[model samples]
Target: MIHSVLEFLTDELNTFIKLKVGDPTTTRIYLSGVTNEAGIAIPDQSLGISLINIEEERVNKDQQNRFVNAVGKVEKRNPEIRLNLYVLITANFQNKNPNNSSDDYVEGLKQLSYAISFFQSKNVFTPENSPGLGSFDPNLQKIVVELYSYSFEQLYNFWSVVGAKYLPSVLYKIKTISIQENAVLEQGEPIEQIFTQSQHKS
Candidate 1:
């Protein structure tokens, strides 16, 4: 499910970038903070998306449904593991410009602005908006992407925790993804309602 979600985002964002850059092959997206098993850097230099955090969603617990079979056999399943995902999208363009003016920082800011607008304009991804998403993971009903803001102190700490120097990046939260195990914890007969006819008083 995680892979599918990321794949969907990667395709959506990169497709936009491809149109903007007028190339589909070169301008691509990569999963950020990734390295080969041999400790070698992977090929990148496009928009990079990296998962930063995941939190369980407690609100969906009430949505789970108890099952009663045809024979009035009752069964109960645990609530789904609802979760929210936080990922960082960083412009992976080269830091150096052709003019040799060291405008990489400026380029990053510009790209970040563009990315923010793209999300703002269309923040919802679902079967209706993006059919490919459901193909990637059928269980994915919808994905709501929202920008997350951080204070200066928090940003500094976040970068420190990432163990990398800060780059031009944006934080987005993908929310309400859930997973339910099919195991039935309990099974029993459904309660029967009995109606007794009152005898006429004589």
Candidate 2:
């Protein structure tokens, strides 16, 4: 079930972002810092599945059902590939405080900082558990932390692209893109900077 959910989220994200499956360039999910004995880090992908474990949160029921349906579709279409999913957790404060008010905006930043710190403290990415690739550099990790910290708008854009009926495209994109530390940030600056630099580039 978890695998299906991860696959579904990957597909949806890719479709919205216009990336291809197994592209090794543009697709990836952000799992949260939760880990198991195998040290597998569960990010957004895992959280998405975890939500299904809840029986009470009906407000998000539609979203959850979409994800489940996505899993079945992905399995029928692409049975051979095992998609990667990332898990990312927002701090309790970020989840509770709506990001509309000025005070919430400031608090959101602080909460983001705390979330990053919590992930780092757990040594989320180390050489021993590099998904059997290689250990991620500490410098790279810091950059990833910074990018996710400063790029909420990009996150919004990415997810916004993942609306209804685009699940297959989204899965293809995730499989294709490489989930490196600075992939998103390296591709585009913080949302504010991108807007600022657009004037210069133009």
Identify the candidate with maximal TM-score. Answer: 1
Cα lDDT of model 1 by residue, 1-202, tens digit: 8878888888888778677657768755676563334431223345578887898977646665678877788989876787899988876545545564323556556656767777898899879888788788888889999999878898898877656556667899989787876688899887789788888888
| The candidate that achieves the highest lDDT relative to the unseen native structure | 1
- Model 2 bad stretches (over 4 Å): 1-83, 88-103, 124-156, 162-202
Taking the tens digit of each residue's C-alpha lDDT, what string does model 2 give over 32-145? 333334433333211211121112222322221111232233111111222223333332222233544522435434434433343344323323433322222222211111
Candidate-wise lDDT, in order: 0.74, 0.29
TM-score of each: 0.81, 0.23
Instruction: Looking at model 2, report the run of 10 residues with the lowest lDDT sum.
Output: 165-174
Colliding residue pairs in candidate 1: none
